[model samples]
Target chain A: MTTQPNLAMRNWNQRVGRTALYLVLILACVAYLVPLVVMVMTSLKTAGEVQPGTIFMWPENPSFDAWIKAWSQACIGLDCRGIRVGFWNSVMIWVPSLILSILAGAILGFALSRWQTRHAGLILGLVLFGAFIPLQVVIYPLIKMAANLGLYNSFAGIVVVHIIFGLPVLTLIFSNFYVGIPVELINAARVDGAGFFRIFFGILLPMSRNILIVALVLQGTGIWNDYIVGVSFGTPDIYPMTVKLQTLVGSQFGEKEYNVNMAATLLTSLPPLLLYLVSGRYFVRGITSGAVKG
Target chain B: MATIEIRNLTKQFGAVQVLKGIDLAIDDRDFTVLLGPSGCGKSTLLNIIAGLEHQTAGQIMVDGTDISPLPPDKRRLAMVFQSYALYPTMTVRKNIDFGLRVAGLPRAEIKERVRVTAELLQITDLLDRTPARLSGGQRQRVAIGRALARRASVYLFDEPLSNLDAKLRNDMRIEIRQLHEDLGATAVYVTHDQVEAMTLATRIALMNAGRIEQYAEPQDIYDRPETLFAASFIGSPKMNLIPGTIRLADGVPVFDTGSDRISLAHYPFRLAPEDGMPATLGVRPEDVAPDAQGIVARHRLNEPHGADTLAWFTYGETNLSARLEPVAARALGAQATLGFNLHKLSLFDPKTERRL
Candidate 1:
């Protein structure tokens, strides 16, 4: 109307507001993506570019050298290998541990929910509380005991350790999920003459679709990411990814090679991360469904 | 299809005694209903008979075998829960036959039994459906079908119709009654709804705070309630009680219901206890009539429930009600009186509220 705060002032104010909003959004996006972007770029870069703090910049010449090296060989105190040396060993320990822990946790959960015996709350509370305990605190005693039994540093030893450590949280999650179910379901099963194990296999197990998926995702992730337990208890024959990754990106005395480290890290986390991304929607739905049931 | 005897059964959870010494014998085809309010321990008794719950002390003889030591599977009884407890993961067909297969029945017989039960319940279409996809009414039918498929000797229903909507509940109630008639299997049902108990039960065992108040035919329980709890609980809108003294008027016993008195022409039983001392006289609202000769009460509020009219009135401090015709209750907010037949009057000892 009148002067309208003059052309230059109005234009400058509009420009500033729009610029600030966009700057914020850009910062947010960069803040989140920087680590992942750096990881990918570092994986492609040579050793010299990584330590110079030019991580935000792109690799001068992108190469598959780090990928091949991480998969085949990169020295770690005479081993001269990357993630490959222990990748299969990690697999050997994880596959069985994940399977057995879920089985035990699921069974325990079913029993706690369906069968109403005395001390149900107490048992449930103990299992839930056990999940919060720091696993590192219990590692030494477990390792000593494992050695005492002459089962130390073996694949079976590590698998069993993973199972024992994994059971508490897995069982807690499963038990809480199962308790949301209607007692009427179990009662109907019982009235149909289905006993303890029968009801679990026939009724409870089948309905536990989403919870089982979530349990798989959770236990799979925990077992895959396990480090201290695997390193301390597992033998040289079965050192999983966590320990192997640490050695892959070892000391800073020599020019560090983050290229191979990034590749190794991404490789190790890929399986469980992919597992979660695929089933993340189901996981959310499972928890929300249980919340509304009660 | 066998008579069951529950003798001197008692159950205690830790230090708290739930069911104190209960004894009853049910016939081979009796539709026995354990009717009571919540926390009355009726469900506990049913579970005990089904062998799902063990008695702290006593014997349960099912078909003349002591089944106290036996588990629920071995006892051969079926139960229907309130929530219908349908297996959501399995199809209805699998849910019904899950038990039979576990019992090691032949596949051929299982199929035959499933067909027969589905036809009987008219649930042939629901066989392929899982419980999650089922509506409330459908889930209920599937639950009944589950027990029906078993061909178990005894059936226990713990408020099975409680989860259904009102209209559907009535329909299911009638269907369950008809099914019971057709099968004539020995059954024990537990429910808080006295209407369900009255309509479905051949004999109602009225429980009050873990004790059986009375056990008799529905008609007998209604017409002549043994205790105050049964009389108050077994009917809709409940009966009204007026504190009045009994006196020998006109050479016969008569009850003075505060404002007015009723003279018994000739009641089958004594009008009052041998020494009742005229404590409290109970009269059902339906029986209390709006007439000049009846007890007078100022009309306070009128609630017209279509077929019947419920009028709340007052005589001094005591507010009373009479269920009458709509036209009769049209003269609202006026001093009204109602006549009560002394022959229909129920006398209860003021202290214990037990009918005399």
Candidate 2:
């Protein structure tokens, strides 16, 4: 009889705690959504309606004129063309950079994990050290090196820069993942007449679905959103979407067109947003298995 | 099938010597088990034989040819790992045919091998499924099938059934023994489980502290362990080692535990017994029984295992156990007399801890 009342009291307390938890979660969701909502509303509104008092208000005259303007007619420095040029360049740059970096990282990670040789630890430590150093610290030297190699202000320059920066983290993640796999598996493969590349492609690569997705998402978003590397290494013609967006927002003349700026900003952010939405589940799984395992 | 020889195999890991000067000659078509507890370097010795691990100093000879310099694959050996080590991404069919394909065998030959292997393991229906989809026993069968499919010169098993439940381990143990006989292949198996070692090994190399303690047939090892380590390590209930001394009562030598005197006339000692020499009396639980002419013991505990009762008793300050029938166990009251079968007991020199 005493336990019954105690159980009831515990149930009531649990209910109160659950309600408070949901309340806090809902508030956080609203706080996160408010900026995106405001951007959407401002992008839809005309120049006259976009003011401080009208920030929370819906667009009374909603249209795609700002989107079309941002996509085509917005001026980015000397080029009066839209961000589409940067969009295509970003796509071309991202595809090759992501592929090359992930491939190099996976091979290096597999080799380090399976085969122990002299300086393996030192090499891993150096690569991880590369990941920790601020990018600004090495950007100047890389720019000079790119110039010396005739890659400066070229299409390949930005791609190569992204790959170099992407490798350290990508290699670390991949190596950690591969290290978690049982040594017996590698030994078994070796006994089965599989050499280095054969075991990697046939055995290890096929099993790297989740970790590959994680690497893709990481390097994809990284390369796509990159601004400083693109501006530093790439010419105006081959500038990425993020750099082009910055040019459009900053180069606006006379009265600012907030709608077009907001539209371009949202457009610039869409690919990574879509990537997260698509691979978010796998990304969580990969991080837990690879990074958090230690 | 061919004979394999390991001569002066030694492995050093940093400061610790894992395998210190190991030598063994395995016969053709023999199931040789490297049996020991963990850290005994049985697995390392197996790896050295397979060429997976490079020995610090050794030569592995198969059919009198030194294969020590060859890599694992070129050594013509197949290994079934404890974890199964099945490629999780590949189907069972691909997993079995992996080696043959790597060897550049004809398409038809690879297919035939896969079919034969899958059929042998009774996993033909599971050929299309990946290892992730298979149960543990099925995976183990596939691992065995992969090794069997290769038809290599030597087969190695590294505690393959230690991952399974007790019932499944027994079933797999029988299957492995059957397969060895069926194929007549030269095999080396490593396991810490004494039951697996005893049941599967045609010739058992019992190891301790990086050295082989005893190498003989399973029954011989059990009946006549050369060292106290072998005697205690092999039995489940554990051989009881009673500290005693050898003294001459009249002319015949007798082992005198502090409280009880046991005759050593029937003991097959390698050395002549000396008076007042320190010794250990090794007695297995099953060899002890209730007898009127035995030493008096105070019954301490009774463990009624279904097959037999293991009644634990205290003789003076030493604990002794007797494996008896349940009825005989119940008849053992607070105080009972216990006798050890004379012929079955082992007499170890206390100083050397070896059979005397």
Candidate 3:
């Protein structure tokens, strides 16, 4: 139906346009990846090789000495050791806090969706308002209350603090996920002899796989990297890795063991970085889907 | 099988009363259809009965037990939603087995019932697949299979066929009728379709503006509707309503349409001409056939609707539709005079719009 040369030129134009867009995207992705690559390569280098002058090259010799130093033998304050000082504490905090916050968000989401009881909208509004309050404003009152309750600087206190901070975002995510489910599904479940909890646990929970996985991965990243709550409520013996990393990098500045600092910084971000590598796309999808009603 | 008695059930949504004191008693194993147009409280009533919604004030008795306070799970009722809410993540086997499993039935019995329901609903091959992979009809079958597996005392269908294409809708309607006949289950179905209500219901509860206008068998509702709303709402192509004055002529009520005066039969209009009240005349389009010996009328328009044609003509300011034979309909609008059978005319008082 068309001339051969004209059709060929049109196809060539389309190919050029597509290739241009793909090239832009590829460049952007490379730009984002470069920082992580530098952190890893610098973590492998010796202190002399990691000097600012050699910003973009591989070291002539890579060694495990810096990694070992970052793990256990470096001086941080009076305690001469690595950021590994609170590794178990970080795991302990990250696990229980993540579990409790996610479960709380999901339970509240299901209750609000199903029962729709009196003052339910008001209650949900209060929760949303709680989320908008600045953490600084609540921290003083929370500390006072924690001290009054004999829980200041305790593991339970920190765990409870993480939960309180995590509620708004986690509730927002689960509520938005539950809202996306069709109301007809719940009505059908009701008519099929399922009560509220039964419908949530049996039907709604199973259908919410993509979003739940996204929630766990997100909460894992948030609590694992949290430094504010760790420093605020944790005892010296129970400090999380993030706080330990902060102190280690702070005091070991002059005579700057650049290798050890870079290694600790690299390790500080490894869990979340690896997590992002695996579940990154789904995480973004769920977060955006939760925000956008459609 | 069980009987359902709804005594003075009412519902209000944000100051707008939906179902205003509805009283109904569905006979045991009867297929009762709540028929209405959109915005009517038919669906609200169905939901109230299904325990998916709570009535503001009322009593609902099933099998002589008051179930007003019972949660949906304790009501022993199953409903097929209009959207056919099949679990998209589960296979047909899991979906149909859900209720049985919840009841703590043994695994073997659950499997056997799931197989039986799947086969009966003609979805045996689809038991391995999720609802997303099935066609519209297959999904509907799975929905019915899920309801069937429950074996509840009452089955509620909320416009379950409204989602299908016209052909599939009719096929499923026939299938539903046959299914009801085979099971003899006490089913309460809701639909806005006249033909579906007519063909499928043992009795119909015609609702309008949140009130039950009439409740009777399909033919009775067609033959003698209680109100002007029911009379006009129940039939296809609709009944023509002509307004005019009426007077008693030799002990028979005759309508005076200014141009022509016609004698009425079999209507109870005791109001004298001294009242001088306005009146409405009603007649079905199909009843206005052109017979050899009949009343004289003028033809105004002809509409060919395939299978049959509609003849529209005005005697005065009132327009009337009549069903004419295909040949006779074609002869219409060719500048010819036609005839009407006054024997089939339906007259109503224009002021109150009640049957005369």
Candidate 4:
């Protein structure tokens, strides 16, 4: 008889505890989502409806005029075209940089982990340490070096900068990922008459799909959204979307168009958002598998 | 098929010497097992022969040609790893054809070879499936099939069945032996299991601490172990070793155990026994049986093992085990008299640990 009452009380307590946990989780999620909700709502509202109190409310008469204006007609200084002007430029800078950087990183990581030289440990340590150093600290010297090579404020200059900054993290991801692969597999390939490149491309590279997606998400977002590197190194004609977006929104003397600005902000973040949505599962698995093993 | 000759092979990993001047000659079409406990450099020796690892100082001759300068692929050898090491991303068919494809064989030849190899391994239905979808035994067959497709002169197995369950291991062992007989390929297999070594090898090179303790046929190694380690390592439940001294009583050799003296008059010694020399006597458990005219010992424990029961008894300070029929062991009470089979007894020098 006592056991029956005790079991009922225990069940009640568990239900209350679970409900409280769910309530707190919901509150946290709503708190984090508030700003994003406000941004989208403001972007959809007309200019007159975009006042302080109406920031979080759904627009009564929503229009995509701001999205269109932001894409092609909003003015930033003398240029009235908008964020669309630098979209192709951002793609050009990001795609080549992403490919070259990932390739270089994978090769470096493979060599460091598998065909280790005497200095591999020291070099890996140095690379990992370099990941912590602020990119701002190296920017000035990089500018001088870029100018000496006659690539300052040019497309090549920005691509090279992205690769350089991206190398440390990319190499760390790939090296840790490759370390989990058995050494016998590599030996088996060698006995199968595979040379270094053949084994790497045929055997290792195929198995690295998950980690590669993780790297692409990281490097793609970082390089795509990069503003400082673009501003410091890109010329006016080759301004990346981020630099162009900054100039579009950073007006000094005109009445601010918050709707247009919010629209542009969402547009610039769309690529990374779509990437995460597409490859989110692989991203989580990759990080845990590579990082947890090490 | 090729005869492998390893002359004075030595390997050192920095401060630790892994292979200490190992010299072994494997005959053509032989199933040679490198048998040892872990860290005995058996795998390292196999890797050196396959050219996957470089020996510190050695000359490896395959069919009278020194293959020291060649790489693993050039050595014409294929190996099955302990882990199976199948490519997880590849289908079984692709895994089998990878070596030949990389060697740039014609497409039809590669296909025919893979088909025949898969059929040989009885894995034709599994060729389209990835390794992750296969069972452990099937994965091992695919790994072996990959090696078979290579058609190398020598096949190396690095404890390929260590990961399987007991029943699967037994089935695979018989299959591997049958395959060896059918192909007549020279194979070097490494394993720590004494049963695997005994069942699979035409010759067994028993290694200890980077040295070959004994190298001979499996039965020869079992019957005439040259050292104490060999005798102890080869048998299950282990050979019972009794430490004592050889003393001359009436000009006849006698093993004096301080508490009991056993006559060694009929025992054959590798060398003539000296009086008052410390020696260890070794005898298999099955050789000891119940007899009225034998030494008396107190029965401590009895372990029933289906076909036979192991009876433990104390003789002096050492507890000795004997294999007996279950009924015979069960009939015994707190005490039992055990007799040693003199013809099968082994005597070892205590100092050198060699058979005397």
Expressed as tens digits, the lDDT of each residue in B1-356 for candidate 1 is: 88889898889999888998898899999999999999999999988887677899999988898988877777778888887877777898987887788788999999999999999888899899888888999888988888888888898898999988999999999999999999989999999998999999999999988788999999888877777787788877777767777666656666766666666445454434342266566677787777667677788888899998988877666667788889888865577767776667677777787877
lDDT by residue (tens digit), candidate 3, B1-356: 89999999999998999999899999998999999999999998998887778899999999899998987777888889889999777898988887777778998889888988988888898889988899998899999999998888699999999999999999999999998888888999999999999999999999999999888999988876667898889898788776777766776677766665666655544544433446766777887766555445668778888888888876657677888788888776533344445566666655565565
Query: What is the C-alpha lDDT profile of model 2 across B43-130, one tens digit per residue?
Result: 9999888778889998888999999998886877999999999988899999999998988999999999999888888999999999
Number of the top lDDT candidate: 4
Better of 1 and 3 by TM-score: 3
TM-score of chain A of each: 0.84, 0.94, 0.86, 0.94
Candidate 4: the clashing residue pairs are none
- Per-residue lDDT tens digits for candidate 3, residues A37-99, read 877777788888876657679877888789889988877777776778867778878888888
What docking tier does model 1 reach? Answer: medium
**Which of candidates 1 and 4 is the stronger one according to lDDT?**
4
Q: What share of the true interface contacts does each candidate keep?
A: 0.80, 0.78, 0.69, 0.67
Give the distance in Å from residue A67's predicted Cα in candidate 1 to where it truly belongs. Answer: 1.5
In candidate 2, what are the lDDT values of residues A169-272, reduced to their tens digit? 88888889998888899999989988888989999998898899999999989888998998889878888899999988997477688998999999999999
- Candidate 1 is scored at a TM of 0.86
For model 3, the docking class works out as medium
Q: Deviation in angstroms for A222 in model 2? A: 1.4
Greater-lDDT candidate between 2 and 3: 2
Model 2, runs deviating above 4 Å: A1-35, A45-61, A252-257, B240-277, B283-345
